[model samples]
Target: MSGYSGTDCQIPSVPSSFAPGHGEGLEDKGCGNGTWTSVEQLVAVPVRPFTFTEAPQTITAGGQYGVLEYHGSISKPHHPGEAEFYLLRGVLTENEAAQLLATCSQALSEAIGSGKGRDLDVDGRPRFAVEVAELGVLDGKGSALRPLVETVLLPLVRQKYGQTAALSSACFRRFVPEERRFIPPHQEYDSFAVMTIALQESASYTGGFFLQGSGKAFVDRKFLQLGRGDLCIFQYDLCHGVDVQEGSHLELVLHFKDSPQAVADGSCPWYSKMVEVGDPDGLFGHALSLVKKDFPAAKEFVEKACEQDHVEALYTAAEWFWDSPFGLEESQNSSASVELWRRAAELGHCRSRSRLGSLLMQGVPGRLQQDIWEGKRLLRLAFEQDDPDAAFHLGQALLQDGDRDGVTKLLAACAKGHPRACFQVAELYREGQFQFPKDLRQSVRYTKWAAHQGDAQALSNLGHLLINGMGVVKDEAKAVRLFRHAAKLGAAEGMLNYGLALLRGSGGVKVDYQEALEWAQKSAALGHSLAHQQCLGGSFRD
Candidate 1:
């Protein structure tokens, strides 16, 4: 389900072939002068597609200096939200592209080609020749490519979806040749429509062709033979992927969704517009801009903005300070950060209160002075305010103290989809620790919930259970896949488990001593004790 329907609305089959670009093949379903007795009847009433046409010149004349082709779906109930795509042919001059490439390449060097602990595919090879995190480069105010999306891409989406669609994700993807380069077909989630812009000439890549799949067989297939600026749009639910053969390829993907509104009195408003219209100095706007960039500067900016008594800035600053590596100074004394959290908590920020409580439980003795009683009190207050984090932390504390009330609190948090609480509940069920009953099936179920939220430990633990047939049928291949995914998320334990699997040739994984050794070394570097021993001991024979 989408926000449109709680129950599964019928997903219609893709028409064999429709107009390729723009609103060329829309049928007018005239329901003129029809009276509807209820909202349901009104929805059932057919509507005609509004008149729309190709407006490349109009778009270009609006200070959009680019040579690109655009294809858009008509805004109608029949269409699955605003779907549009652009081909980036000469939209960016060579000089401009080169400049952007250089700037981003330099800015994101660490993230590029730096697979610190990513796992190999089943073939024991890297997934891509190069997979750059180009989003990091474009997230800041300094990014040259920001305007291309904010100025051009967003406006095009608004033209099709009206002004209510907000940009969900704008991603720049680069694919290069590798031993196994083709992407497996997959479906997208959390978005209504996806628009992809080709950034490279077809000749640059070999055999890497985009195909639209109906989650099974291919409905339509197209090679990269289209010109660079050729654009494609598809409903997010439609399965799509590229068959990579050789050379390099680059693309820009824009995901759109209906903007969530704070005040949904049936009249929807763009979330960004609400922010812009509320604060006089656009304080939230400035805070958002800073938060999107380097974390250190973002912290400083939020701190300065908080001086103006901006609640959002106070909460944002507290959050940035609470997150490790981003907020923690090298000295590791979080007294100053804790004070910020306390200040935000004093200002009635529920999340900040919860965060402050959690930090206080750590007993970080400093300017704020750790007090267990005060921490628990704040946790109770925050929990009463219906803060999920507060419930999770308080539940954990209570459980540690052998209090049964923690079980109810944890279940409440789990019901709300709190990943940590789900993981905790899963652990309790697995071990029958504290007040939980021993149930491996329940463990697997809750672990799955946590894993889906990207909990690395849950993924790794679930892999173990899957391979051992603890609560489910044994699936060695699935276990290996889960371990690989968990390892890719920088889980040291996942790396060690995956390495051991390679060493023993378990989970259908072929024995590759060199690869196993590499994974062992990586896990050891991340402070996994067993991996350290595995790295030191020459037990695996090549």
Candidate 2:
């Protein structure tokens, strides 16, 4: 493990090698030679502890460096809103920033391994900027992130918002200069608040970190110039985005949701404090905490918030009574669910309106009276606001009425990667149903889209097409792979097809008759009649 005797440390920004419990000599990278050991996590510390940045007012200190809240503006206010985000300077030392950056790089590499989370072009995401992997990855357990989140970040949240929250997820965002990556102004639809730390110096990148006016705030549009070891904090309610014009920008972003489990006792004084101070949102958060713990008391809390006209709570309360958890209908009161949704819909809650309208149109048995006219009206209102589910539901209703416009609406939802919508359009194209003018190519295209979004049926169907060279060029090898994946996803047809493939050793796969029998048995058990016929009728791949 012998390495460098250098007194100066420049904090290398690249990640350490993935191998654990060993030192890799990094003389070539030249931030001052050192071995990266597990002891330092991602840090390749020099022989001695050395300070990097001087002082920006030392309110926070850990041995050598001081972290202070930056009171000055990060960017000039361009829009009509107050600054939605604030910064803390000197939050990490050069070595620590390097460590954090490495951790983020490795985690993102693992989670986003040649895969995409969002459907392409669905959210207007630039192909280059859409590295949206599922956050927290759960398997990683945020172990590498615990010290940073629990110790460094959550304390800042408590200090800033007076709200008790915990880490729900974390994601890595790397804006590559070669890819010309950048993010435009948009509020996060996913998290309650966001904490992002710059893993590199401000000079490491250019033209990034800007905020815009959103919600009730009169915040001016401003850009932040963060140095190494700096922290930026804000609620997702605040409109913000990033812009990177030059070098690569590595950001370790953490999303925190209001969780009572953030505290050991599953309770927090700040929630009550906010509630007592008349913030209904606090009561809503508390109710969610109770619901997460399956405490029946959550029901009363949610109802109380609904009484205060809390829009979100009203919508949730309806759901609470409408559907039983995991089919335990004993707790469900569809009648009560309809009442709450009716109230929320009257207040212009889009989802509530859509749900209530669908229930009314279908006539929920022994619950909602049939009211198709009012139902369609409410659905149309929500759809006019571009609610995708509303379009899908209304399309279904209209399709039952033999309306051509129904397919058009379904097409709109399909474009948004709605699986049912995609599957319906695929079927229409395949069978010329509903005057869709049978286009097998369109069928294949839509089926591919559905499969990419993880539709098991579409996956099996695509495999079927590949096997027969229908619409798409035949590739039995690829087809078999798709069948295997689909079968793993629990598609009964996929199991049947995969079993046949295995029995015949099709597409370079070794023959495994035993495994084939297993898959055939599974598919037959799942009620795939064709599966039963295939094995019994001697329909092997050959």
Candidate 2 lDDT over residue span 192-299, tens digit each: 567877777878766467654322111334567777777778764455666554577777677665554543344434466756765666676667667756647777
lDDT of each: 0.54, 0.61
TM-score per model over all chains: 0.48, 0.58
On the 0 to 100 scale, the lDDT of residue 83 in model 2 is 37
Q: Model 1, range 199-255, lDDT digits (tens) per residue?
A: 557677664434432111122233434436444555543444555444666655666
Count of backbone collisions within predicted model 2: 8
Candidate 2, TM-score vs. the true structure? 0.58
- Model 2, residue 167: what's the lDDT? 65
The TM-score leader among the candidates is 2
TM-score of 1: 0.48
Given candidate 2, what's the lDDT at residue 220?
Answer: 39
